[model samples]
Target: MSRPDRTHFAPLLRVIHWTMALLVLAMLFIGVGMVSTTGPAYVSLLALHRPLGIAILLLALVRLAIRLGTGAPPLPDDLPKPQKLAAKGSHGLLYAAMIGMPLIGWAMLSAADDRVSLSPSLALPAIMPHDLMLYWWLRQAHTVIGVAFFLLILLHLAAALMHGLIRRDGVWQSMTFGKIPGKRD
Candidate 1:
């Protein structure tokens, strides 16, 4: 049977969205910890960072597929053209970073001849040949991209707040839980 049209995202998509949100936030902090220490704690942080990055990469692929197949709800009609363009551009950048970050990290490690070890018995094969120069370059690019990704996230949060609070538009509710303020189920 055909289901009723959804004003919000599909349940599965919402679940993945929130789950990835937490994971990504944890990753950012873990990344900072990994870079800031060189002691016993660094070992623990690296252990967490590698596996978590792979998980994010895999989940991002699944999320992108679901998004493409199901599509998102339209933006509010009153949203300005510039804001609409920004929304589209930002989402594209978000997905790009979600998918690209891990790949770059893996390649960076690969160029350094390091294994992407997920566990004592499991590890991913290197995708790039050992080249210290290349590894150094990728490492710098990764840090720059990571900072840009974080800034993009902040902008995204501000936009969401604008929609949910100042604008009182349904755009924010489209991806959120519960019934929209005035809309019936």
Candidate 2:
């Protein structure tokens, strides 16, 4: 009923954060499932994967817009410059990966243009022609970019834990409970 505490994230931001987090995790699963399986299994999972990838692409764009318009809270004054730099680098990579992965996938599909059947009844059209060259290239790019994104996720988690448990700061609070610290004093 009331606004989120200043030290905390607004409800909208929290929804975006958690929703994005879950979507990213699902994307990872869909990706892994697609590769680990073949034939009918891969095809079925991929049907879900393709549409979801498109949706995530849209969501990421919206999230970025919101993030730009609403500046993130400032870092604790005591956080060292180097750590701050690392934080920035990691977050930037997260954003880049979010945008890059979907673009590459769409490009590859567009180039393939083959009727890649996600299921027996539902065939998802490829975005491109079936050029072996383009397919291989985008596939490689996707893999490499995905790895980078994976590592960034780990670093993001580590940073959150560090702030929540060790630093005892309100950084985690902002994202989780939707509040910041030091305001009560």
Candidate 3:
């Protein structure tokens, strides 16, 4: 049976949402720091980044599956059509990046003949054939997409805050702890 309409997200979904949000933000910053520094710390961050990217890739798959199987709370009726479309479009893009970035990273490393080891003892097989030119292009694409993803995240945060603070709409509450202020069905 389909899930009953509800204001707040399913508890598990909420947990996943918050968890992925934190992880994604951490990955973004870690990526920047990894690229900018040169030292022991950089090496440590690089090690951390590999496994974290894999984790995000796996989690994104789970999140997408759950999202597709469940219904989300509807947007507030007062929100304009254009705003609604923008919200939907941005969310779609976020999901795309969430899934694409990790795969790109994995393939890039494979193309560069680098190991995809998660831990000292746990190694992953190559995802793509080795090609220096492909590696270079993927690296550039990853960087550009990372920046765009970061900006999109900022836009999402701004919209959430607008709903939570200025608009006083229940949009934020649907995903947050606050009560659902209207009918769910």
Query: Model 2 compared with the native: what TM-score?
Result: 0.84
Query: Which one wins by lDDT: 2 or 3?
Result: 3
**Per-residue lDDT of model 3, residues 1-185, tens digit only:** 12346666666777888999999999999999989988777999998999999999999999888878776777877899999899989989999999999999999999999998988898889988999999999999999999999999999999999998888777888787767555442
Q: State TM-scores per candidate.
A: 0.94, 0.84, 0.94
lDDT of each: 0.88, 0.76, 0.88
Clash count of each predicted structure: 0, 15, 0
How much RMSD separates candidate 1 from the native structure?
Answer: 2.8
Candidate 2 displacement at residue 151 in angstroms: 1.8
Per-residue lDDT over 29-129 for candidate 2, one digit per residue giving the tens place of the 0 to 100 score:
77877888666879777778777777788888988887776657666779999998888778888888888898888877766665544456875556667
Output the lDDT of residue 72, model 2. Answer: 70
Higher TM-score: candidate 1 or 2? 1
lDDT over C-alpha atoms for residue 83 of model 1: 92
Question: Pairing residues by index, what is the TM-score of model 1?
Answer: 0.94
Model 1 poorest ten-residue lDDT run: 1-10
